[model samples]
Target: MSNVKLKNSTTELRDLDALHHLHPFTDHKSLRSGGARVIVKGDGPYVWDSEGHRILDGMAGLWTTNVGYGRSELADAARDQMLELPFYNTFFRTTHPPVVALSQKLAGITPAHINQVFYGSSGSESNDTAIRLIRHYWTLKGEPKRRIIISRKNAYHGSTIAAGSMGGMGHVHKHSYPVYEGFRHIMDPCWFDEGQDGESLEAFGLRAARALEDEILAVGPENVAAFAGEPVQGAGGVKIAPPSYWKEIQRIVDTYGILLLADEVITGFGRLGTWFASDYYGIKPNIITFAKAVTSGYLPLSGILVDDRIVAALMDHDDDFNHGYTFSGHPVACAVALKNIEIMERENLVARVADYGAPALAKLLARFEDHPLVGEVRSVGMMGAIELVADKRTRRRFDNPGRVGLICRDHFFREGFIMRAVFDTMVCAPPLIWGDGEFAEAERVIGRALDLTLADVAGEIAA
Candidate 1:
């Protein structure tokens, strides 16, 4: 009965939200007509809406909640820090204990020879910092003309102008303000879509990676500063590069003396069963931009891990650095992150991902690899994707891309699951705390959603 009243209140609240609230990446007109789903609470891999429906969160709140939802440890840490010292800026030569401890913890966990930390509230901010630091580093080294940063197409860095320019999504750039200059975009190593009809994966990967060399020379190596990329492209349909891709990328960047910046915002903090994708792939980038899972979505926190070589250059230059945020190292956020890491360590979550979670997810998702509706199935660590298609042999897309994806996305919610659809590819990156049971449930629900979508698109599919 209480759920009934709560549902009514939810309707009223949704009405209020439609009148005033503006959501990101949403079609406001359509949202106002359909109304918003009010999520009232969450507990251990599940969230309850106002109508009392328990939905399994497969995306883990935008791929951040590694420790899962409703962990009291994180809440307690935030509360304790709030009581002790809620607000204190890291600027003005004043640093708090939580920030200091977190810095040490981050440096210890990150790759060797990378000891400096710069804090921000989100990945966008950290990427912005990367842009400035890269340009400034070149300036300090007396080569201010080395301003161009190369990234891959279909990459997602962040939404800020600087970060967006660094990204390769032209549609996102068209809708937002004008993109800033000094950024180059190369083709991504998407073997499924970009590979030739008879080409091998390894051959395609090498060709795709060589595009970086082509771009650097086009921009002139003397003017190039860095090459930025997500270890695995998350928003770009959970695309996984071939094994040969990164090695070739590292080689080209090294040959040109350009900085390699790994954007680990999605693959960081054990998402890939390792501390960072840099380690998983055996590449040591000069800088790593991280956020999202750093605090397990418990609090907003993000930062960059700068190599000691860059730190040395900055120290010798003797400038203010002139970058930071009001909440640069907010004590409360650092406290939550510290606790989140502790929980992950105490539970051995990283090893579990390597030993159990990833393997189970791969085995489950592999069941759909040959399904008519699925063009491809890819999984790495806890993240995976099922690409929907109109014709499997040619990898042909739907007449209207993202239409079938929206249909499947709605079906996921109706069937009590939350999996994101990027265009026609359904992506999943569930919380690391999820086990075999949760994995089975996800497989069942997603399988059913695929069946329903297949039926809906039967006539459109080419037999």
Candidate 2:
């Protein structure tokens, strides 16, 4: 196509999007004014915008796409499945080969105790399923009153009503007014932000874990059904708890006999170098919610891996669970996920993250810790964060919480990379396929962005 035609197409697309597209978690007003960047294509770890900019996909397409982009094998899997069985509901006690095969694959890879799968089309749906499933399990055991599921503040589970209520972000909750009952939250283990002055990470971790116990006591243990959390708080600025955190959390949940729900939507399927973050953290959860990387975002698919104990409780009740989506166990999505996993295994992607990607990313991010505008640098597996601060010594934030972050994020885009900003914390989860070349480019692009952001926020730091 001619450059003139391409430019016209890009402009026309942007105009149409501004007119009709209502994006999730986006300010429509701002989006309309600024216009969204039109991503045209992706290959390996890079995406090309409509403007012909080749940028590193530092976020792995919202923490999915572990196998990177343009894998014809995944497309072929989808095409084959579509040709064979495009749409078949898993209702009426009916089953298909793709779903069954994927189910077995998931069960084999998940934690030992988790042997059953419940399907949905997104993380939000999966989490909503979890809420109902947890309550149902307790009710089956004759503890219907145990409905409250405790989570950490600022955590991002999903955007649906139930999932949003379960998450602790006040912004998300505001829109979900009269927020769903029986959901409570405690402080997240964001040591850099919430830790007491001079407190060690270990001590802060213990304190954070104890908060669950505190909330449980306040709510009455008998009334609490389970504790839910992401093993690594991905959307909450990649907040990784200290070493002591998950161990203590496990002990607390065990003590109270409440179920543990690990929301591994972002960290599952080798984002954290393990099949699930639960394994990485060494916590045995009763249920594990998974999505995103399961199919590398080739198609939307999400689900929960139920522990055998819960499955047994569910089985004891002879009636229907009365919960599921129309597209539950979608055959096409299942086929894509199966193929995605096959590629990951054949290429050893998970081990690649563990042995090289994680360490390399850590080193790359660490280089920015001494930047004038950076407060701290942290990473776990492929996930990473760089805290933008006005006062590094005092860990003080800019006046407007996300203002600096947005600025930095824009800088990253302009510098030929994509990085997400949670308030003043810039986070990235590059594809597992990223190697020395990607890391080298990231260092250059990210350093320039940071320097540019620092220049933009110099006045705030001075004040």
Candidate 3:
């Protein structure tokens, strides 16, 4: 590690954090006892902790830092914008150059039908906006009863009350008491865990798609406004659907005439080797929620791509939409996003992921397929997952979900790598900048972690 200096020692920092910082998605009691790892610096795909241990970032800073870290260009963009505009709101009939330029660029890259944008600071806020827009659009069309939005079980939309309600994760819902009404969930098309024995993948995919139709019928099609889903369930352990899934979903939604909302917060901006996953999957959504990679995690910015039809409805309404954020069209965030897109385009990161990064990562992940703890390994574009199981042949998960995955995750962190654990699945979404050297290092670290985790649970494995 390079010579680094800090005013306070690591222990002091941890003490201060433990005293004041309450982290998200954390067990506070456990964190207070064990303390938190202090991340001090980041460059490219590596981050250095307070103790100066350089760790490979396998999850791309929560799957947002697509262009990697420490990009002087993004810094320059933010600095330049701060020096000029600093901050401004897009509300009250006001407009700004940064947001306008970013919106135009986004329109050029998103699905052809999506020409308008609604700005927010995070995916959660934007998803909330999507729900309002969906219901409001139907209300404007004189169908006030069309309010229910169907999402898939285990899919994660966001953390806000409304967004969290849209998400189908039971754990999240347990916290959101009386989850905001108007959202229903169906089974996710996760073939590995949910597929029945003797069911072909194609058949399972169709069945999963049919789940949406069934839900719509059960809820009464007249009361359903839209269906929301991630292209490949990112937070749900990188759950990639079978080839037949999306096409069948599109047909079902079309037959019902309900809107489709593609939550591309994780899959947008070249993560899936396309500007938007909707384009890659060939699913025409009325709205596409995006964030994360747009600014490449350099700044907080997220929004939704509104189909022209929705825009037309708003235009015809001639009144307030009654929703927005203080950080909507934040000039600094928009400026950084503009520069981020420029860098991505100049480097052809999207094409690189499609042609090389995806294939390379797939090959790297496939190396773990024969490992004793691995039941399945899957990847698409820059993301991948390894299912850690007790019985590989039977695909039997460990007794307690997330227990073994946490064990393996800690091993990876201690081994100077970062991989997220979702239940018993270890998932990774590396920086788009990774190449041969990063892959080689990832292979070594991942293999070592798996071996350590296997030894920890060796007795649990079926002979």
Q: Which candidate comes out best when scored by TM-score?
A: 3
Off-target runs (Cα >4 Å) in candidate 1 are 1-8
lDDT of each: 0.92, 0.93, 0.94
What's the distance in Å from true for residue 458, model 3? 0.5
Model 2: what TM-score? 0.98
User: Candidate 3's residue-wise lDDT over 351-402, tens digit each?
Assistant: 9999999999999999999999999999999999999999988999999899
RMSD of each: 2.0, 1.9, 1.9
Better of 2 and 3 by lDDT: 3
Q: How many residue pairs clash in each candidate?
A: 0, 0, 0
lDDT of 2 at 129: 96
lDDT of each residue in 264-285, candidate 1, tens digit only: 9999999889989999988989
User: Highest lDDT among the candidates is held by which one?
Assistant: 3
Stretches off by above 4 angstroms in model 2 are 1-8
Of candidate 2, the 10-residue stretch with the lowest lDDT total is 1-10
lDDT, candidate 1, at 215:
95
